[model samples]
Target: MPTAPCLQTILALVPRKRAFAASNCRHASLTGGTTIIQAGQIAWVRSACPAGSGPCIFRVLPLHRDGFSIPVTDTPAGNRGARRGSGGITLDDVARLAGVSAITVSRALNTPERVSPDTREKVRLAVEHTGYVPNLLAGGLASNRSRLVAALVPTIAGPVFLETIEALTDALARRGYQLMLGQSGYGESREDALIDAIVGRRPDGIVLTGIMRSEGGRRRLLASGIPVVETWDLTPTPVDMLVGFSHEQVGEVAARFLMDKGYRRPAVVTGDDHRAIQRRTGFERAFAERGIHGVPVFTVPAPTTLGSGREALRALRLAHPELDVLACSSDVLAHGAIVEAHAEGLSVPRDIAVMGFGDLAFARDAHPAITTVRIDGTGIGRQAAAFIADRAEGRAFGQKVVDIGFSLVERASA
Candidate 1:
């Protein structure tokens, strides 16, 4: 489809600077000249608030972009025994309060295994009591590597993506990368914003659920120089690495299966996803070869539910009562179609045949076990992990199109 656009050339936008500095400047002006807090650093200056005779109350203002707060106090500049350190309790103070050395406390917090269990527990309790928060920004700046891998998914409400996400998380964890997830919610602008926010953090790697992205987002991603992995949909040229099967192939295969089974009038139940639409296009093209016209297609909103399946079937029956076969975009939808057929007093495969994509865990567990196409999600995951590993380690990775073929798991449904 459209030659699957160039992976790198498609997304080459320039990277924008992190917005924290500008945000901090605005915050400083608004809060008077009491303190200058930016990034992870906080400095105390003379209080600009009105002078009062009694002890002046300290004001805490949260710096939105920097992710730290500014603390202001009205204590006299040279007062006796006045607190003159940073706002929060320091790690040394926590260690002292716990009656342990700073190194032991650090070890306890970062690597508890090396320290005694008793000492670790004592240090943890002291830390909680002292309300000490680790300065992650300072640590990240020092290392220049956040060790955070940002992942952007179309939506988390859909189950079709859960397997890939779980696999990605586990795979990155094995490589010492923590996944920071963001939901794009099927909006291009939202995806762009999320990408900008994620790239600003300078994550070690970025994983996208789909290959499609806005031009600006693509450019920023390319400029970030982070390892990128696109999954769940296939393209000839990938931005970095591709791990998915073709939706068009899935549609053609299903149509052929239905034709071979001698179903004259076949209808389809599809979701609104771009990949699903592609499958629908392929299905229609394949069905046209059999001289089928007005082949009764029903579409439902994305993140498809069983109710949509049931409604699609009911709609099809009203329009084309003779429609004997139905192909669904997902097994979840197929299950709903089967339930709807039963509700209408029709026996599956005998009175009405059904087929579905995604032979998920529940595909075989239904009353009339659903016949579906099986794609090895776990295998795709492993392949994606291998691709990322090879790139990250500077190894030669060849063979771009890895078609871990699909199989038709025939059952009682069709």
Candidate 2:
């Protein structure tokens, strides 16, 4: 939401220093040192990382009063032949073991099409035998690109994000950027680690699943120059850019839908995540407008499974026996609620109406056909890709903040 500082302003803020900034830094991974402008990207030269490097990377801390910061390299002196960055296998070692040139190894790893099948197979076998990992930072340094983007999601096991991931993957691939995924789980600690790791890698862009809520995390993101896209939820004060819908709006519409259907004792089954809570707030506020109060919420862990859904229903049933409708934060939760209804000898929509968010692939296929709120996840994916690609390629585009929006999918369940 805050205006990002201009590049020149940022550059002016940090003073030029000859010495490395500090020692005993803890962060993840490496980005090649030395930067230049090319191909519409801020290309950088990647410095070498010897095996058993003392530290993986340096971080950009809060700007000092001097308006300058020093970035440090990771590799320690000596033992260069034994290890690379992160003390892992180096490409040179792989080339040596494979009886091929390092260039051939790079071609085999980065662009196998440029190498003969026989040579590719040889490099592949050598890679397998040596456990040699390609340092993408080196390649990025050489080519003046870390043609990578990182997407941080709560959990990869959930189906709600799969569509966006698939679409985003395809779209970015067409533009020559590889996707690096990180699972932030369900809390701040995970987010902190992921942020440090991601920014350290110097990814061209970062795509987050929801608005960053933690103060420390938000500050960290704002400090970096990388382009970011926050998806699945919206906020006027996004870290950089955003592509999502309003959770409160979904909740209000869903709650009203149930009320319009004449279901009075409606309860919500929600995952215990930030966005889910916002949707629940909207749901509660809308019901309050209709003179409804004390609407119960059964909360469960994130990446809600069918079992959790069923269990949530059972728990709610004990407390609110007269409940006739179940609204969920995700289709997966709704699906579980339907299964539990059958267990209670209740017929969906007849004995109980159900509504869910996220019109997942299986929503329509469910026995009672889930009625849910639908967001244009594919559209979000495509636009997010464009946002990153356009920025990385130095193309100007309007509207850094985008609300791809959502829809209501009415079905038999509701």
Candidate 3:
């Protein structure tokens, strides 16, 4: 008898229709020297016979979209049998283990809030057991959506942004989207690098902590056509949408509040961040309008801490003991100033009044309940999420810029 043809020769002889007739075929055992090619719900098998035995055979089999199994095939001496490598664990594996659909598994991972607690726990356990890592890039390419939003903040250590971040995360989860956070530091270079990395990933949306300051970063954002939301700072000309209050207005109001309370000799202890400087300028301008020019200012590095605040207050007192009131850039700094004043036996409000920005929790729980400027951080976060979701979902929205504004909270410290 003639030797059996090689696998490639047999494939060449078979017609494309017969080789790919997956619907007409039934499941069969695969023998030695068999190679399987899978495409969607179809599989093509090529089985080679021994020399002088019989002609090679080709078969098609229908398979579940999620998975399939192949038996180990023994090869003749000095001949390597064709084999398929295990493709690793996948979403379908987790779904099968959890007794749910693949889409349900995906929903549980991306938006657990949409699924019941029990179902979510099942999917979670399945994922944990199988070590299934979601291929977001593949899914995103197929569906044209990553269902992910990227957010950049100046610093994660600052308590002032905690409310906004929490609100953003909650709102996004409710809408079946996830948030990826990045720290842009307090410099242009770091922000620009982060923007570049974020843009390359092509997220559904981007949330920025402040208005884009770098010209290159602004240009990239405008060119990328991604929905952008600038938060915590205001600008008439934003790259896309904006939800923030004016830092200048916050400072001016703090200054006027002290002036109204009969604290005439007022000075400032502020961080050197961009927003802090803007507030300081506003404070000085307000006092300058009343011929009170040259207000004493003590500056600390960005991300001001309690130690810096204490040092600032001490230094300001030594230079201008007449300064009866002090305005601080953050509640952390103001809290320090209050502690230092008490340490020096100076009575709060009576001896040295102190005001702080970002009415954080410590401001309310302080010894004298610090007077401070209150910005609606949660409101900004929710509004920003809404803006990004609307744009991502192709909903028409008229508002591009929103000023959440700020308020003065007077307490015992002032």
Best by TM-score: 3
Q: Please give the range of 10 consecutive residues that has the lowest summed lDDT in model 2.
A: 4-13
Q: Ten-residue segment with the worst summed lDDT in candidate 1?
A: 5-14
Give the alpha carbon lDDT tens digit for every residue of 1-414 in model 2: 322211110111122332222222222233433433221122122333333333233322222234333222333334343233343446665676567998999988878899999999989876765446677777899976698999998888888888899899999998878999999998989898899999988898999999898888888888988899999888979998889999999899888888898888989899899999999999999999999999999989887889988998899989988989999999999999899989999899888888888999999999899999998889989989999999998999999888887889999999
Prediction 1 global C-alpha lDDT: 0.72
Worst 10 residues of 3 by lDDT: 6-15
lDDT of each: 0.72, 0.78, 0.80
lDDT by residue for model 3 over 69-122, one digit each (tens)? 222122222235432223345676577768889899988987688899999999
Q: What is the alpha-carbon lDDT of model 3 when measured against the actual structure?
A: 0.80
Q: Write the per-residue lDDT of candidate 1 for residues 133-200, one digit (tens) a residue.
A: 76656656866666677888878876777787787778867765577899987768998999889888
Q: Per model, how many backbone clashes are there?
A: 4, 13, 0
Error of 1 at 10 (Å): 57
In model 1, the clashing pairs are: 11-218, 11-219, 12-219, 13-219
Tell me which residue pairs clash in candidate 3: none
